[model samples]
Target: MFVIDVIPFARFAPAGALSYRFNEYVLPGTIVSVPLRKKTVPGIVVACTSVRDAKESIKTAPFVLRSGAVTTTGILPKSYRIALTKTATYHLLPMGVILREMIPEAFLTHGFPKKLFAGTGHSLSFCEKTYTLRIEEYKKIISCTKGTVLIVVPTAVEIDRFADTFPSAIVVTGALTQKKRLASLKKIKDADIIITTPKYSFIPIPHLAHIIIERESANSYLTVARSPIDTRIAINALAHERSMQTTIGDYPLRMEIRPKPGSALKSISASPIKIFDVRKKITQAPFKALPEQILSIIKSTHEQHGRSAIFAVRRGYASTVICRDCGTSVRTTDGRPLSLITVAGKRVFRSSNGDTVIDAKALCDKCGSWNLIPIGVGVERIAEAVRNNFPNAPLVLFDTNTIRTPRDARSASTKFDIPGTIIVGTEALIPWLNPSNPISLAVVASADSLLALPFWRTRERLARLAFSLTERAEKVAVVTRRPDDAIFTTLENRLDNAFFKEEDSMRKQLNYPPYGHIVTIRIESSITKIEKDTALVQSMLKPKTGIEIPDRYATQNKVVRTIVYKYIDIQKWSDEAQELSQKIYRLPPNITVRIDPESLW
Candidate 1:
């Protein structure tokens, strides 16, 4: 008999591997079916030792070892396994969790085809430009590369776009039907180029050599659902371990991924960015959501039979409702600001979480004041303004609220494609706009509102948004209350170098990203037990470097407390955090640790 150590693919599985008895010797990376508690679960075999060697250890064990059967005959690639281990360690998660997340459940439950290729070359390149220019470079590389080249994009729409460009390339996406996805997975070995979204980028392909990550700055790469895991980081780790050549292309690449000075590809020509001082507009028309200049531009575009786009940072009619009498803001039960949204033509206040809803006429919870006023413009407000100003214009609302599914996105894109149609939306609409068919005009309705977001990368995100707009429109107009803000100067001057230098300096001063790593530990418990739980985490961590303790707040009938740890060396800090995480995992309170979280909140 052989004693095999298995890491069960369960969310709440223990941190360490469990011992299982097997009749045959199983490879370390092979998938096996093991009895975990009352049910069978798929696990990865981490180690194997003969019964003769582990006889004494098994004899002194607390419980009998369960038998595990090999579910998949082929083992995972050694380099891939190492990459997974590094990912687990860096993210402070169990190997099982990493495995469960990285690989599709179908691949684990049912056997997947064995990998047929081993990457042999290592090179990393960065292109800080739009897809219009990047596509040519990608084509050249794809044509020159002998082995199968994997291109990863952020969305299904992008997959479709790339598939159209490379008609012979195999396309894999979650949008595909089960039968189609399975067929695509089976045919990956024969395809020379595979275009896929980040979700299925790990689909084992034969002769895979080059990895091209388009739109590397896309937020979709960093999943925020259950636990945050930056798939970009995981992909980079995998590439490094497998010695695969990597090319990451994005317009204004993320600060963390930006190439060292003078090494990145030259940026493409940008459209003229006109900044309108919204403060002056507000002084002239106190209630006007759309500035006069933007209205005139829309009129001109419509007259010329050209398409126009209006971008808003928020979705609802108003981003927040503030009580004038007591200076109190209307908020949800969880302390999130409430936005006024028009549902079925009736204005109602809804929380950002989209759960709590109240009539617009409702009094403030804290002040009980009827003197409440809506503050900050949103997409709905912008749409309403456009409708009033240009009553005869064809209008399309493009946002998460409107475009929930792929079908909806297609419909929105089709409507926006019509000449003279005005599409109003949030940042979500940027990716759908095609640069080849540039809009006659594009206006950022409220740049200040987007910049007001409390995040370190707000400026970077705004710059990216600006560039994306410039790429898709002939003329981009930004309406900002703070016209003197450095972001506007950067946009007007097209001085990305100056902007990046300033951004880097600020990040270094604040010890954000590139300069340092932050580990966010979120603890949730009853209002009564939250204080104790927070205290326990602080005491246990005892971080020597910078630490932040934000005030605990109530969310969904539970108190949520956040503890942030900032450190320089990832290798040293990750080890210490991993040990502490295991201890905290045993506690009663629900806790989640996120390393290098995309956002502090």
Candidate 2:
């Protein structure tokens, strides 16, 4: 029987190299059931090999393999596989976990893909908001008049709105359920018009057509977990394989050019990134800052035949619980707040099974008062605040707590049937860029909250957010105590094009990614002390490679630290990365290590 290398479908579990033998004839990229924990779970077949490193004493030695019947299930293109390996190695995550995101979950399984509009596609003769024909957009479809058209956008908001305009297209996104997702993917292969998120383009299409990125520079296009797989790289792959030229707005081009020359050179025309700075509007809002600026703006904007949105960072109602007598937030050791609930019109405990409510028997550590109040509003709290303030305006709440499904939410927003409503949400609000929705103004009440964080890439993100704000609305009011900070200075200067280069330089100098190589090793073996683990890592590396500690930690049995490798031996580095990752995999049960993490943001 042939042997197969399978990556079992488990995330964040104790990991080991998945080279063990399995059933027969399964091809690469095909999903199959493998033993995991108490039962069998499905996973993608990564490779086929006769190589076996396990001891002869093991019963499963020379494990048999099986070929998956899914259309001669295949490996990703060589380039994409290499990129995927680099990300998995760098992040120290299970290779399979990264692979799971490599292609979508659907095409690997039983169902067929679907097209966006298909038979009921809403044609776009004119812009929904402007009611004016965007003949500029139509030219591509009518002019090509041959190959199928694939229009990709950074967010579902754009996709939902844009897809309906086309008469027969399919919308593919993370929001679609597993069955529907596969249906959409299968059906869209031959579709004339296809709307999709960036990553899934790796799936083959029936024919090559013009590629369009609705708004290019969206942070959604960035690899939240890996750098090389960003939308820019995906487009390059398409161009290389299909000979189709990709189109992007001016925004994404600027970020990519500084990192690598000609990385973003698509012959292009773009609308200007318009800015409506409301720095002056906040001062004119009748107070140094309107305590309820978020709610008031929503009420006023909707009243004026325009829609408005409020953006906050988290879910749930109130963000913090504080003793009114003294300013101290109640929280847990894990950095999550100590949550509360009101049951049946009266106060109750957080969980029926755990912990005591209200420290009636205990004193407040800060003020000795039993009275506790919540501060720091979340998106839900802000929505309720809008309700309290507007009382009469039409309102729509969009957030994790309220919206059950992403597809439903995007579809709801796309309808444009409900006007004069406030869309209050978390990071969900980042994509609502309707150019002619009569959304004349926007208010970022806590825009600086994300900027003020201490993460490595805060400055770059701040600039991106500011640029996006300007592009999203005609008038924007950014609320912050320090309106004159350096980030804002860079953000406010429309003519300042140096932000990318300067920020890129800093990321490089610090040995952060896109500048150099990085890996975070989390050690969990009880027998090994923190210092011993550190030394073990140091001895594993060569004297020539630059390795430095960004941070080190130890809490008895738990130890973790990040190592930066700025100058790599390019010829052998990739191989070394794989070897080291394998060694990490075989480490004792107590150790935990994740390489390049999802957010240093």
Candidate 3:
């Protein structure tokens, strides 16, 4: 019998590139008709090779033969293989698994949609900026070219603008209904240009000449929460396989960046930025009262002056409803701040016990208090405050959910026609404004919170957000408590760009992403002790396995324990890790090991 080589589809192991064989003539990159045990099934062909002579001599085959009937689909382009292999290795995934994401989802089922565009492209450029996109170059491409164009963006907001700019284009995302989705897919298959998110674009299309453009080169956040596959590598692979052209720009280079304390978004009529040190803004703000000053700013912007927006990063009335008496915060057993969940979002927590879902009304584990308050202010809460302060103000609010829709944001950039239209929001809330209206006034409250975190990407993220909003807004004011910290100074001056560069270098030196490879594994058990699990990991991964098992179980709580292993025998370790994970998974109904994590935080 001719042996078949089956390849798992992308969804089978998201963020993982390991291609598992079903033990059957799996054409390269094609779905195969095969048998699993006594049942007929489907599998993908990743690679074809003769059985090794050593193995052949040791074990006699059960009449498995190398026959000419098996077809060759040609080697998946060298660049395509490099991308798949690099993504698999660097992302700490199995080589065979990562290959899955490269294959379009449509090909895994029915025949290929070759009439439509498909394939990956080499990056022409990369931008870490928000809502990244090309400048004059993109306009040039569309004007001269006349083939089916597939342009992928991280958010629908970008797609909306693209649709408007190019009226003939069609947009597709998760928000579309089945009918709309099918229509959009059909449009993708038929139209000259298709603008869609990555997952939705995984149609059965083949032989595509795609132009891969990323305003923000796809990031980990690109993973659809349900499927959790990084579309960056996958889409790039497809683009390469089909000889598609690609252009990447995280954000515009000429865009504003708060490089210095004196610099900030100076209005479209002025410079890219007009930095306002909160220290001085604090002088403008009444020092005697905090919230009152905030309220007054709102009042002035609405009743006393022109339109402006206020941003509060934390959501809910208060982040923590604490006990003033005990001076203690209500917290989880692991010492995380307890939050007050909203009525709708709170009830939805019941759906996922796997991830910690705390109800806002749930009493504080410390000082049982309905006196609970929300610690951080979210976009919704900020919007509510603005609305309450200026009851008669004609304003439109935009958040992650609403900004996601291009139609809903049609008039988002228009100034308060009724005089005092104001928008209050979170970081994401501010970015939805019309790019042309680059002179809007805004206030960013609690922007300092993220600056204080120890995470490697914190500063870059903050800078990106600030840079994006400041460049778009006319006069932007950031009110932060840390007016003297490195982050503050970075925002206060352009010298901070150096810090970002240094940080980038540090990440490179440490072998962290864009520098090295990162794959994290998390194990959980309800009945097992943290110490015992750590001991087992130490014993199993013997010394000089060349794998770095960083100081056992970094953190542990009542529900779970975490251990991080950096740069080791990742492929073999993954297999062994699976066994250990299985062992803990079998502990009891309550114990579970969340395997092959795409994210650590």
Q: Which candidate achieves the best lDDT against the true structure?
A: 1
Candidate 2 stretches with Cα past 4 Å from truth are 7-95, 104-151, 154-157, 170-193, 206-305, 315-330, 333-377, 380-388, 407-419, 436-438, 498-505, 508-513, 522-601
Q: What would the per-residue lDDT of candidate 1 be over residues 1-601, giving only the tens digit for each residue?
A: 8998887777667766888888878777788777776777777887899999999999999989876444544567777788887777777766666776677644564455555556776789987776688898999898898888999999877777888889999888878887887777777777899998887777777688899999988878877555667788788888887788999998877888686521222545878889998565225436889978788888998999999999999998999899989998888767878899988889999988787889999998897889999999999999999899889889999877788888998877888778789999999888888877788898988888888887777887888898778878999999988877777777887754566677778777877778778878787788887778777777767645325566545576687777788876644765765676666556552878887665676
Q: Point to the candidate with the largest TM-score.
A: 1
Per-model lDDT: 0.80, 0.53, 0.50
List, residue by residue over 79-173, the lDDT tens digit for candidate 2.
44555556666544556656665565455554222221111221222111111233354555546645666666777667766666665777877
TM-score of 2: 0.67
Q: What overall lDDT, based on C-alpha atoms, would model 1 receive against the true structure?
A: 0.80
Q: Please identify which of the two predictions, 1 or 3, would achieve the higher TM-score against the true structure.
A: 1
RMSD of 1: 3.6
TM-score of each prediction = 0.90, 0.67, 0.67
TM-score of 1: 0.90
